[model samples]
Target: MPIKTTKKVTNKKVVKEETKPAVEAKKEEVKTAEVKKATKPAVEIKKEEVKPAETKKAPAKKATTKKAAKPAVEAKKEEVKPAEVKKAPAKKATTKKAAKPAVEAKKEEVKPAEKKKATAKKTTKKATTKTTTTKKVTTKKMTKEEQYAKLSLDTCLDLAKAMSMNVTRDSIIQQLILNPDVKSVSKDLVNKYQLTGKFNFEEDGYDEGLVEVLVSKVYETADIKPQKAEDLQADVDHALNYKFTDVVADGEEYKAQFDTMRKVLMIAQHKDIHDSKNLDEEIGIDVEKFVEEFMDLAYSVLKTWKYEDVDYYEHFIYAVLSQLEDLHDTYRNRIMMDVADLYILHGDYGLGDADYGYILRENQIKDYIYYRYASIYEGVDKDKAKQIANQALQFVDDRFTYYPNIIAVLEG
Candidate 1:
């Protein structure tokens, strides 16, 4: 009985807590009741907290609580009514406090419900988004290899043809290369090996294995350069700058030619003061030595090279002619020009024209030669001088129309 009364008093603290003296009185009453129960009834005792003063306001709160306690029913009712909706912090706080009794056991119990709520909320959000929004799912475009394959087949065929490859066979190979696994098998197959020079294939009647035979020839003609066209382009650049790679024999010989020619021009210009002003004072002595070294290196560099390529031969010949002219070796250059002319007449037309043009434009062979011959024959052989001048005119172009004036200078 005392235990029940103490519990009831503790519970009753809600309302009576407003009046401090009343709460103290209630506590004293609970103590007396416990004493009475202990003393009078060792047998049995029952106590009712039926005091109207104590129970009246408490029941109203209890009635309110019973309505609030059935949260499911109350939520349903609120849903139906829709008018009693209100924010209630005190309700939330009380609910949180009441939940503390079994918080440990209930925490686990509440987990699945919270998870279900979360899942449902997520589902609803996704469904709403699906209805209200439009989105595009994009994938990456083709990678480089894929793009290369995706190019038009016609474009591939044209590219192969321009590169002097057999179109059908190369196209098959290129198409096979669409598969990376297969592409690895042919990494070294379609290499860029150049087949230079002119050769008659009409009598050969389209040799089926010409490409292979030509590649073999390149190895023989140009040394087995295995680094693809990368090295070939570099070779061209070096040649343009009058240079050769160290791989060539006597690779510095062209430097010597230039060095001799450079000194000839310098010495010819400053001959009156050569005793005092040195070549070093004019262009530093080291420049002449450096060019000499280059020529020494280039001496036999062209030995292995055949004059088979028309353009390469022409450029080589022109460089020699220019160097010779720089050294005032016009007579020696005439012999070189005759050598080039003989080679061109053998079949190469391009080199022929280049040699002819060099002589005609420089007025070396036409003006100087005719003048030299005419001066030697002047008065002593007037008929011979006129005949030589007329012969010179036949070879000269209108660009060198001053040949007659050159002849008149010789005559004077």
Candidate 2:
């Protein structure tokens, strides 16, 4: 009974705590309820609340809730309804606050997964790019090798032919055949080895293996007999001594002399006059020396026939003069006078013009050389010839014969 009394006291205290605002709300609702008993919905809600409260507030000793306790219970229930309405918005606010974190947590969870997926995509892209680069590098190397392999034998032959234009036709083929990988030889292969020279093919017939055999032959016959200065000098002497008995023979002889002179000129043009050969006994006589020696010999031998064989004299003088240099004054004067005489005979006035320095420095037989040159120029430029003749007159001595005819031509 005591415990039951204590529980009722606690319940009453709970009701009393809500009573202040509830009583105010109930007074407001009662005024409104009387005015709108049939029309207002809040009046019906208040009556429903009152009925439940009356049943709950029955005395503790009664088997059933006592009817005498009804009015107070109804008033208490109306006051409690206002408290429950106030608490309803608070419960909804608590539930909304709890639900907000769950939504945020879902977004946070999805963000990491999306980031991982983006990262995976980037990694795959990088991997694909690397694969493509590696494939391109491999393919490029393969293509270059294949390009070299695909080069045709015809192209090789063409390269050999083109290079042969400068060297020999068979020389290129010979080099290709000598190579261990002859079948693989191409234009670039020949270029890599840098093979060149004249071709001397001795065989009569043509065969596919002919080029290869020639190439092999070059290596076997690579020995060259070093030419001595004496041998070259002998050849020149033979060429200069060539003589003619008649007009037909004279043309042929002159042509031979000119051709021989041309060869000597070609040899003189080489930078290494002696080449690689060591011909120690032959001193001070290279291609140039050989040429000078030949000229002196020709002049001594040919001077007797100069007036009768005008064509031969002209040819011989022009050949010697073509390779002659005006280095030693005595030697130069002899060559110049000989060339000047040839010019007079040939009517080539331009060839007779000598350098003034070369003329002034001539010491041996100076008067004779000056007079002779002056005589040649008299037909072209008489005033200039007279001046030269006057200069020659100063050098005349008892040792020399000053020709009166030279003076007469120069004066005219």
Candidate 3:
């Protein structure tokens, strides 16, 4: 019995020991469960904090993007403003180019106007030149014979005077003969030498003989036969022997008759005295007798003559004076004094008649007379010569151009 008891007790001890170990293990497990619950709550709180921080960071990033977009927009507006300014300058350049074309067009218009004016001037010059050339051509087309034929006897005389040629009857006849028309020549001859009475062919005077000779020569030159020649001869003879009656004494017809006689005498005497080799033989009279007779005849004619043509009488006196100078005879001073007296008387008459040319001719003659007197008295009477020379100086001027000897004496 005792041995059974000891084995059961040992089994009970072993069981108790095993049960204690199991209880301690259960206590430790419960403590570990409680710590795990506390740790789970702390992890949940940390997750909530992380979620709020992430929301704030998202708002900051969106603000930065908005600022960047504002700067880009301002830069784009600045670029657009520069482009607009450049376009305005380009528009101004275009307007300037257009104005240049307008100026050039105006200049072209002015050039055309100037061209028209120049053309007008040129046309006027050409017209004037053409007119002058036509006039010259017409004048050149006329012949000398045609020109002379167109002239009248008066015009011919004027031409002779203008040409400084001698206006003599022979020169006039020569000029008249140049006319081709025979009727004109016949008419001229008839007008110049027509007679009104019978002429004495056997007249004793040299002038009558010379007139007869001149008529004969004219008839011979004309060679007009029968009727015309007879008429001309009869007319000339009548004119030569025309009688001066009291009824026609103051008439133009009587004056013409006296003029014809004087002309015949002067022409014949001058020709015979200047051209004849033997003046006495040609005139059938001594030189002294001829001069005396001519002077008497001229003085008689001058006393009766009351015409404007005093130059005709002057010619007659000058012819006789020239002959006297050639003779150098004792009658020279007397004849010169007579001529001077005649000139003085005529000069006084010319003052009343208002003939300036006659007064000038008288002054010339007086100067000549004084010079001649001075020369003649120079060797004979010194005081008288000096007095005459000083008197001549009063008339000395450009009109004394033909009297160089007179000027020399006056100066000396």
In model 3, which regions exceed 4 Å deviation? 1-140, 150-277, 307-310, 320-325, 328-332, 347-412
Which digits, one per residue and each the tens of the lDDT, describe model 2 over residues 225-263? 233445456665665455546555555555455445544
Model 1: lDDT of residue 298? 36
Please give the range of 10 consecutive residues that has the lowest summed lDDT in model 1. Answer: 39-48
Separate clash counts for every candidate: 18, 1, 4
Expressed as tens digits, the lDDT of each residue in 1-412 for candidate 1 is: 7976664543332212111222233454434333222222212112223343443333222113223222321222222211222322222332333322222212332343455567667979999887665432232344444434444545544444554665354333322222212333233234432423322334432222243332332223332112232323343234335644455433344544433433333342334222212433543333234333433343344433444432333333334333334322433444445444444434444564465556666665466544554454454556655765677766654566557665574355
lDDT of each: 0.38, 0.44, 0.41
TM-score of every candidate:
0.26, 0.30, 0.26
Kindly report the root-mean-square deviation of model 3 from the true structure over all alpha carbons. 44.6
**What local lDDT does model 1 show for residue 327?**
25
lDDT of 3 by residue, 1-412 (tens): 8954553443232222121222342454435333222222333323323453353343222112223322212222222233333333322332232222222322333344455567667978999999999999988666544544455555544543443334444533332233323445444443445421223323421211232233333434542222222223333345444444544443444445443333333434435444322543443334444445445444445534554334444544454445445544444545445444444345443332233234344553565556655664455556655765776667765576436666666556
Please say which candidate is ahead in TM-score: 1 or 2: 2
Judged by TM-score, which candidate is best? 2
Pick the lDDT winner: 2
How displaced is residue 99 in candidate 3, in Å? 84
Candidates' RMSD to native: 21.5, 28.4, 44.6
